[model samples]
Target: MTTVTTRTVTYQADALTMVGHLALPAGSDRRPAVLIGPEGVGLSDVERRRAEALAELGYVALAFDLHGGRYLSDPEEMLARCMPLLADPDRMRGIGHAALDVLRAEPRADLDRVAAIGYGTGGAIALELGRDGVNLRAIGTVNGLTTGRPGEAARIRCPVWAGVGSEDPIMPPAQRQAFTAELQAAGVDWRLAVYGGALHAFHHPPVDHTALPGVGYHPRHAQRAWRDIVGLLAECLPVAE
Candidate 1:
């Protein structure tokens, strides 16, 4: 196993103090960087481990926070906080940019070679960054096919890859069609993968707390989605050994 180091970082956004986790590979040479966003439930061990995994793969990674470092275990609270934030693209951009700044601040981060990947609400933020014309090598989202203003999507220069469960009630076929149509109209390079028999948040591991309906964990699909995400990163933002 490759040696990696991680630390807790705190930054401010939207008048709230956000705590994020940063992970780096063993060496000092600058490497491509990846920004990870957590699901609507907020940043937890899942995202932190992802950052660590990316670091092991030789990319500087940061798992950014949502809800100001608070994890929403309550379904009502998660929806109440995420629904409004998701509805406001500007707000999502604010969160994404703030985390990007943190990632860029790292000495080993190659600003010119960066990618943004998110799950759930975090995924929406990644898409928003692309819409905001952020120069990303690639963008990956899981169960986060939320649509944005078409005009803004035209500004996205990087390739986008999204994955969702076929049975996801939150992002059903119609919603998926609308999202792809927006991307197609904008002429953005994009791809979508639907995992059969998987539900929303399938990438996430089983949780002890209660979750809303239509959300569950699928270990097998989760592994497959991670491989796809890594493949996208490798294709778009290869890290030299």
Candidate 2:
């Protein structure tokens, strides 16, 4: 196994103090970097493990926070915080740019080669970063196909990939169509993967606590989505030896 180092990082986004986890491979040379966004519920061990796994693959990865360092397990609280934030693309871009600043500051990150991938609310932030013309190599999101202003999406310079469950009530067929239409109208290179019989947050594992309705875990689909995300990174931001 490759040697990997992990650390907790704290940074600021406007007035908000954001905390994130950074993972780096055992190498002095700059490598491709990945910015990971957590779900609306906030950052969790799942995202940290994802960063670790990316480090193992030789990429510098940062699992960024959503609500400072708080993880909202209560469904109502999560919605209260996320819904309004989602409605405002500028706020989402601010959060993503702050985390991107931290990731790019890392010694191991290759600033010119970076990707953004996120889950749920985190996914929306990733998309916002791309829409804001952040010059990402690629963008990937799961259960985060939120559409933005068409003019802004035209600024996205990289390919975009998104995954969602067919049964996801939150991102139903209509919403998915709108997302795709926006991307297409903006001329962005994009792809969407729909997993059958999976619900919202299907990529997440079963937690000890209950979540909102229409959200559950689908182990098989989760693994498959991870493979697809890795494939996107490999295609767009391959690490150099």
Candidate 3:
């Protein structure tokens, strides 16, 4: 892996001070950037490691935060915060844009060559950014197959890739169907990969806290999804050789 640097970046979104993890490649050249969003439980070392991993691959990565820098391990507490946040697209867009601004402001970031990738609630924010027409090079999400408002998917200008678990009750077959239908009708280039026998949040590593129902980790699928995301970035926003 290439040398990389890591830091904490504080920003405001949804009336909360978000403390995001920023990772930079070991170079002075302008580089493509990626935004990493965490699950509903909020930003943890899990996402921080992902950002550093992307940095090792020579891309600027910002693992944006939710819940003002707190990790809500309590399922009830997380839903209490995320349910309302999810219901308001504007709020989610606000958070996404706020993080995007942070990434773009970094001198090393190539503004035109940026992508958004996230998991769970964070995945939903990534999709929201695409729907908001943010000029992203590509969008990738795991367990974040959230359908957008009618006609909004048409605004997305880049290809979208999503991964889900076949047995995820939270995002069952019907939800996947509806999400794909919206994208298809909008004519957006999109693809979905369902990992058989996997559950929701399959991309996430095992957590120290109790997970919600239908939420569990699948190591094999997690590695596969990461590879697929790397492939997506390679095709759409490859780093300079």
Candidate 4:
């Protein structure tokens, strides 16, 4: 049986109190820490489950809330709250750094082998963190965009893996191609995995109609994505002897 423990950590961002949940493996000793950013809607049960699963894999996982304690089910409202952060990449980077600070404050987390994983808007934040040279061992994204300031490549210090749906309309083929070219030109160690027949938010097993437009949950893709994430983390953050 797998055991997981959850705790609340308080941190300040711009003088405002932000709360996050730290999930830990039952017997994990000095394991790497993973910071999990929720989707536009907020830290839902699904996101918590993802963090718990990571903890079960013997990593300290921190699921931070960028939206305080509020969550909206309506897609419009979710976008209203999330669009500002996406449009202003600098602000998004600040939020990612804030979450990293929270993770570093945890006693069980091994700050040296840190990684950030996100979905959609959250995914963009993960990419931003890596691009900004946050000392991340690795970064992973699920159906996230990669466009941002150009100079970020110089600051990137870790490998990145992005998973996207081949049919994802949000991140169209042309944009993906451009993004890939940019990463290549920047010489960032990165991998892009496109899942055919899968749509946006493929890793989210349940369709959130209120928060997503024309979304369909694919269990197989989600499972595969989960495995890929674990494998990537293992590769990037090898277990300490």
Off by over 4 Å in 2: 208-210
Candidate 4 residues lying further than 4 Å off, grouped into runs, are 14-16
Residues 1-241, model 1: lDDT tens digits: 9999999999998678999999999999999999999999899999999999999999999999998889999888888999999999999999999999999999999999999999999999999999999999999999999999758989999999999999999999999999999999999999999999999999998884335789889999999999999999999999983
Query: lDDT tens digits, residues 114-163, model 3?
Result: 99999989999999999998999999989889999999999999999999
True-structure lDDT of candidate 2: 0.94
Candidate 2 residue lDDT tens string, 6-38: 999999874678889999998799999999998
- Alpha carbon lDDT at 103, candidate 2: 97
Candidate 3 stretches with Cα past 4 Å from truth are none
The residue-level lDDT of candidate 3 at 235 comes to: 94
What Cα-based lDDT does every candidate model obtain? 0.95, 0.94, 0.94, 0.81
Q: Roughly what TM-score does model 1 have, to 2 decimal places? A: 0.98
Top lDDT model: 1
In terms of lDDT, the poorest run of 10 residues in model 1 is: 206-215
Clash pairs of candidate 3?
none
